[model samples]
Target: MELDFSNIKVVGFDADDTLWVNETYFREAEEKFAALLENYETKNKVDQELFKMEMNNLELYGYGIKGFMLSMIESAMELSNNNVPPETITEILNLGKEMITRPVELLQGVEEVLQKLARKYRLIVLTKGDLLDQERKLERSGLTRYFHHVEVLSDKKEENYKNLLDHLEIKTNEFLMIGNSLKSDVLPIMNIGAKAVHVPFHTTWAHEHIAPEEHDNSHLTLNTLSEILKYLE
Candidate 1:
């Protein structure tokens, strides 16, 4: 879809895969986790079971590496029939720490695009996850100077975006969200009368997925963040 952005005053960006390498790390961690518990369960079963644990624990821990780590721990315990060794548990914790501390790798052209967009419109990092971890990654990323605001959402539903727009005093039509998930970044914003550009990441969490037929026709899709410049610039 071709979008006219003359009225887009605020541009929102999702942090994880949209800005940097996130889901890929999680994928790697899951592999390591599955391997750690392989003696107790098959790798495929462990992966399936971990996804279930994550979904069940979403309310309790929200989203982030910490929650994922906890889910892995719980899955390990259950897969092992509660006989998972203490050392293995410790290893799991360390795995999470490694991911949390991993170097931030921004996607191609992300910083350059942000730099350009920041000059013309209000750019904010609109993402959901552990507050401290998000902050840490932003600080480490060195992309902080381009963003006018950095919001960490608990969830990216319509209400959350509405509340944020209200808090920021931004008119619905004047806000534009650019991110990697159609489910979180595109659908809800479009529903709330705002514009969104879905910059799809190769890896998306299953919870954030919807059937292809369910996609609304009103939004625009971009293969890469840099492509946003064509419409916005």
Candidate 2:
């Protein structure tokens, strides 16, 4: 079946893994975090516990390094039976601080794709995370010039997309979303009758993983962001 983007007048992009190196940092942080707790638990156990903590705390902390930092600290205390040293907590905080300050490394062909798409479509950034962090990353990415509007959502649920579209005065039929996470970016957009293109990042956070049954065939998936030009441009 052929999908059409001829009606798409607005294109939304996800910030993290779609446009730059994000999950890679979180992965690296997890490794470092696991290593820090190796004395009390195995690396694998530490990894599992940290992910559980993040999920449990998702509602309270939302997302981003600050929340992740808290999860790591709490996980360390639980995994170590509250016997974890103060220095270990400091190190965990440092890990997140390091991530927050790390330079934004744009994915391959991100700029090229955005540049080309911006000319024909009203480009916007629709990423969800800590507001300040996402804004900082966008500033650091230097790709903000290409987007007409930028929105940092708390989550990428269907309602979030619908409300944002309405606020922007963009019709559902005229909106297209491009992102790496099928769970966050593709599923919701498609559910709302908008088009979506999936460009998978090499590393995806576990939370972003969706069940096979939840997968919709209506959206397009590209191996690389650059390939989108073949269809959109």
Candidate 3:
């Protein structure tokens, strides 16, 4: 379907995968975590239980690596019947810290795309995460200069976008969102009468997956991150 973008004054980009490497690290950490707990449970079971732990803790912790580490620890203790070795817990903590300090690596063409769009429209980083961690990634990314506004939302739901549009004083039709997750990025923005583009990252957190029937026909998916330029330019 051909969608119009003539009135999109504010273009919102999801930071983690859309602009830089993120979920991939989480996946890596998860693999290491499962290996750490391999003695207590099968790797497959460890993976499954850890996901459940993370989902159950979402309300308490929101999104980001620290919460994930804590969940891993909790899962570890439970799997080992509270006999998990102390060194194992220490390893998990180190993993989380290493992730927090890892250098920000932007996706290919991120800078070029942001630079191109910023010249024509107001650009913003509208991502979900722990505020401090997200801000640190942005600071390291060096793409902060491209965005006119930056918002770190607790969650990307329909209401959140509605409130964001109100706070930015932007009409729904005048805003566009681009990100990697259909659940958190595309659908919510679409529900609010805004435009969005789906840019798939190689690895996706299972929670972000959604039924195809729930997606809006108006939303677009680009084959690659830089394809948005073809539509907007």
lDDT of 2 by residue, 91-115 (tens): 9999999999999999999999988
Provide the overall lDDT of each model, using Cα atoms, as 2-decimal numbers.
0.93, 0.93, 0.91
Ranking by TM-score: 1, 2, 3
Clashes of each: 0, 0, 0
- Residue-wise C-alpha lDDT for candidate 1, range 1-233, written one tens digit per residue: 77788999999999999999999898899999999998988899999999999999999999999999999999999999999999999999999999999999999999889888888999999999999999999999999999889999999999999999999899998999998999999999999999999888898888888998987567888889999999988
> Which residue window of length 10 is worst by lDDT in model 3?
210-219
lDDT of 3 by residue, 146-214 (tens): 998999999999999899889889889989899999999998888788999999998899999888787
* 185: Cα error in model 3, Å: 0.6
What are the root-mean-square deviations of the candidates from the true structure over C-alphas? 0.8, 0.9, 0.9
Q: Estimate each model's TM-score.
A: 0.98, 0.98, 0.98
